[model samples]
Target: MTSNFLIFDCDGVLADTERDGHLPAFNETFEHFGAPIRWSQDDYAELLRIGGGKERLASVLTPELVKEAGLPTDPRQQRDVVLSWHAYKTARYTDMVRAGRLPGRPGVARIVAEAHDAGWGLAVASTSAEESVRAVLEHVVGPELSTHFSVFAGDDVAAKKPAPDIYQLALAQLGASSTSAIVIEDSHVGLTAALAAGLVTVVTQSSYTADEDFSGAALVVSSLGDYPADPTVVLDSPHGTAIVGHVGIDDLIRVRAAALSANSTPGR
Candidate 1:
């Protein structure tokens, strides 16, 4: 018998962690570290284009910016400095999660429970630190459901999203084929990674990714939609798969099948 896997991307997908959670944590970390740097919402939105937190922080490092910010000059020292900042940011982010400052996405708990009941193999693939990822996952899905998730995050893979390395690593660790799993991602970067790895993907747009292109996704929704209060809004479905009302287990199965069909094409 074949087993199915549900791979979730933390942060935006699991919880609206970018604007509320990560952005604030990053700004606070910089303040705490005495680096006269603070990422405005606009700046951080652009920074999200970079995959990892440390990578995002490092992207602003130029000769002028480094000197202006009084950051370390030596290459090794610069790297260490970035690592330290990232460590502090992760700690701050974890604290925010524990404090329930970041709430899970609309349908996170509903879908997680549904998926769990169906015996799906669950996992979280993220560019964030492991502790942060685990904390968010536990908060979103509760302790029991979170335990069912195999988390692969933060330096676990040499490359991050849009690289396919992390997704590949998750597939390997889960001992599951790319076709047997479906990825729930919020950004084009994560979509690109999942697609490159031959996995089906359902994109739930987040604050930072609303305008980003997700041309290859099987289905795109505003949120997963827990029902009554928050309903899943279908943004795009290239395969013509119908998403009646909120997206539920049936919708996911159909989306996965559509992806499988799309991927099974000749030379594709």
Candidate 2:
């Protein structure tokens, strides 16, 4: 069966916005609030395991960091502080998008144009804030493609990636069944979310997520594709070759075909 909708996770998949975009925005927010918490690339690479911004912050807060930062030791107050920081970080992240500091991932424009022309429904389901996601989408696909997408993002639901709530919401809102949707992700968390929702997923490893596991993805790749200026390079792996450029509808159709075939076979 062919996937009727292509679902995207924003941060690493649509844009290589983490190092140049998100990390600096987060540090700027921490500075503005006079907080001692500043996440370096190395620090955030570890935190990426946690899935949500506020959740990641909560994970690292110890009695010592709280005391040193003059934060309340109580769990509720800690939650509030993390939420406040995330709100500020989101604003700064959006500001960076507005300033054009972040560029969409290579081949994003080409693939989106191809999909749009083929009449495929497009949507972005991400843990990132809606404003930030929409900004990046606009930058990548222009206003027309941006407007065509149904966005389900931050805080609209109770749980983040690896929980399937966001993807579930996107599927419901878009009236797409799991079998009829394909998700594009960069992290294991996002991959887990899509798989749990019973949708096939494709992974494009980003800098922060390259070493993470992607056992269940239908396809795992280095990037979507390279353009004229940038050559496409596929990574060889023990499992298979990682897709890189101009991966078309037929490629995705093959993935679904393989998945269906694998499922229908009797036990050995």
Candidate 3:
């Protein structure tokens, strides 16, 4: 029998790790290296638009930032510095995870449990470091669930989100076709990546991704919901409000069905 698969993005989707994990880690790395740079929440929010950590750092190497930060003008030197920063930032982020400072987003553990019980194949596709992704998986879903997932993360593929490389790699690794799988994403970049891979996607807004556009998502929600707490989170947007219940295998199945129907329709 064929199996259904669900692909999830790390960072925002699994947890609000950007604020608690990434941003702080990056800042700490900067301070450690005496780079004279710090990313406030707003600053990091803008930097989040960039796909990669190194890319985001490289973006600030402008004349103004160079003047302000006293950075090297040589392109190769700048690249090396950015790589070093990212490496250190990754280590700091992993330390935060190891210390159990970052918690899973509401409903993440429950949803993963439900999906696993229903025999869904699980995978994570992320631009973050593989170790970071693994740490999150272990934290949110526990070691058993973590062991079950096929993780495709940073440096595993040539390109990052909004390009579909990671998602495409997940599909290939899982031996599943796009139609047989669904993706869960928080950022517009992640949603774009999943949709571009011809997979149905569901959006669960996180702290930093609440304002992102999710035009192609099968459903856009504020969260997956918490059992014994709330069963759904109503998503508010200019379009209207959408009530998304705590996501389960059924929700993913429905999303795949809708995508199949949409694909079948002409001019859709």
Candidate 4:
């Protein structure tokens, strides 16, 4: 049996972890390992284009860094070295999450609770490491709601986003149809992946993803909006669904409903 699904992307969507948590963790890992590779905010903004953290680390391996960091020169050995760095970084980042250094995005907790109570299939589909994603999910939505989520992350699929493999795997595991799932994503690559998998996506722009394209998202908001504290502002809404202070499960259903109707109409 299939159920309606609400899938979330871990990093930016669940919490604004990329800037405060991940970036610092990566730097700290490099420092702890004596690697001279340190990325500034602007550098990470560009690096965000890459999908997986391992890939991102691989992308920055320079001859100078290899020698200075005492990394193995052999290709296979260097791959192992990069893997170790990523593992360490994941640990550091998860620690930050467990310590509550990163705050959950505005309405993420509220929406998660509401969706769970409504019996919507909930999952997190991300390219981040499983433990890292789990840590952030638990920290943001709490240990109680986190238990209800199915997490599909890291090498769960060979291809990462901007590729649909992760989302496709999630759909299969969740026993959900494309029209029955709504994805909350915070980056252009994440949005592209969810769209390619035929799921309706909503973009809640993060610190690093505000200017990226989100033309296909059913809704694009500043944050999910937590009532009076942080009201979500619609950046782009393809379905034109009205959002009050925050987005709830009802808004998600309406968005998916509108998406289905549009796709079902003639000439669409």
Candidate 5:
């Protein structure tokens, strides 16, 4: 079926949350905790491959790092430290959101209003905390449109992106089937998760994800754009031809219709 639901991946897809918002927040958290740890840009870029904030924090706990940072040795204490760090990071990120530091991507607010008015089910699925997601959504689309989004984030599922758990949870909670929904994602992992759930996906490049492979995306663009001031440059498309510049809500509908048509075809 043509997509009646639109699911958004937070962070990169909604706003450029990773570089400006999240990175600083993480650094601030590390400083506040008196940990001799600070992830340089390159270091954090590698860490983004991990799913959640706590997961990312835990991933840095090698024996050397643990010793250098003087982190708790006990497993329980280690887990607690990561949790506390994540909580502080989340708060800092939310503060950044509230401060209007992260602006919505080119067409995010426009497309969201369009989708909401067209009666599409709107939602955000992410590994970030629900509070952080809400803050970013509200900051981007304002309180009214933000309310229309059903958020599935943080520890909402046992597994994170690339595992299909978060997208599956979103589909279930939105009362929609994967075939009836389209997901907008920025990272390869996010695209894989959505695709694994059987949803069509559109990729808009983000800071850290631009060079990553996005082999299965139905459409790939620099950003979901509004044209003129921030026109979108098509990076890839279903057919091997040059695509027109700038993508709006109508382009999304065409993409969804094309996906539905393809899915209905018989295959081996």
Candidate 6:
């Protein structure tokens, strides 16, 4: 018997964690460490383009800021500093998650339940730290559902989203070709990575990624849509797969089929 896999991105895709969960944690960590910077909503929105919390922090390491923060000028020593800050940030982020400060995004729990019932493989592919990802996953789907997830996050791959390393690693870990996997991503960066790995993808535009380009996605929706309460809105379907209801296992299967058909066709 053949198997299909559903891989999710943690931050914005699982829940709207970027704005509510991570952003504040970063600011709080900055305050605690007496760092000279705090990422406002606008600043963090731009930072989301870069994958990984450590990379986000590393990106803004200017000589002036380093000096202000008393950070080491040596590359390796500087890395140690960032690592400590990231560890603290992860703690704060998890605390917020444990506190139930963020709600699961529409359709996540419902689709996860549907997928589980159908015997689909489940996993989370993310640029966040593993602890942080696990915390959010548990909050989104509860402990029972989260246990089904195989998480690939943080340094699981040398490179992050927009580079394809993480998604490629996921496919390799499954020992399966990209044909058997589908990725659900919220950011263009994550979408690019999935496409680069030759995986089918659906985009659920999140708070920070709503205005970004998602030209290659097989399907794009506002959310997975929990029937009766939150309806899924189709934003774009490049392959023209019909999404009549909340995106479920059946809809994802159709999207994957349509993508395979399109790719197999000649003369583009």
User: Which is the leading candidate under TM-score?
Assistant: 6
lDDT (tens digit, per residue) of candidate 2 on 1-268: 2248988999998888888888888788778878787887898887787766777767867988888889898888888988898888888888888788888887778778887888889999988888889999998778888998889998888888889999999988888888788888989889889888988888888888878888878777777775556544554232343344446666676776666556467981
As for candidate 1, its clashing pairs are none
Local lDDT at 258 for model 2 = 69
Q: What does the lDDT come to for candidate 4?
A: 0.91
For each of the candidates, give the backbone clash count.
0, 3, 0, 0, 0, 0
Superior candidate under lDDT, 1 versus 5: 1
Superior by TM-score: candidate 3 or candidate 4: 4
What is the per-residue lDDT of model 1 for residues 155-197, given as tens digits with 9 covering 90 to 100?
A: 9988888899999999998999987899999998899998999
Estimate candidate 2's alpha-carbon lDDT, on a 0 to 1 scale.
Answer: 0.80
Superposed Cα deviation of residue 22, candidate 3 (Å): 0.7
RMSD of each: 1.4, 2.6, 2.6, 1.3, 2.0, 1.1
Worst 10 residues of 4 by lDDT: 63-72
Instruction: Evaluate residue 204 in candidate 2 and report its C-alpha lDDT on the 0 to 100 scale.
Output: 82
- Measured against the true structure, the TM-scores of the candidates, in listed sequence, are 0.96, 0.90, 0.91, 0.96, 0.95, 0.97
- Tens digits of lDDT, candidate 5, 230-262: 888888887332345566567787887777677
Evaluated at residue 146, the lDDT of candidate 2 is 90
Error of 2 at 137 (Å): 0.9
Residue range 85-166, candidate 3, lDDT tens digits: 8899998998898889998887788888887888888899998988899989998899988998999988787777789988
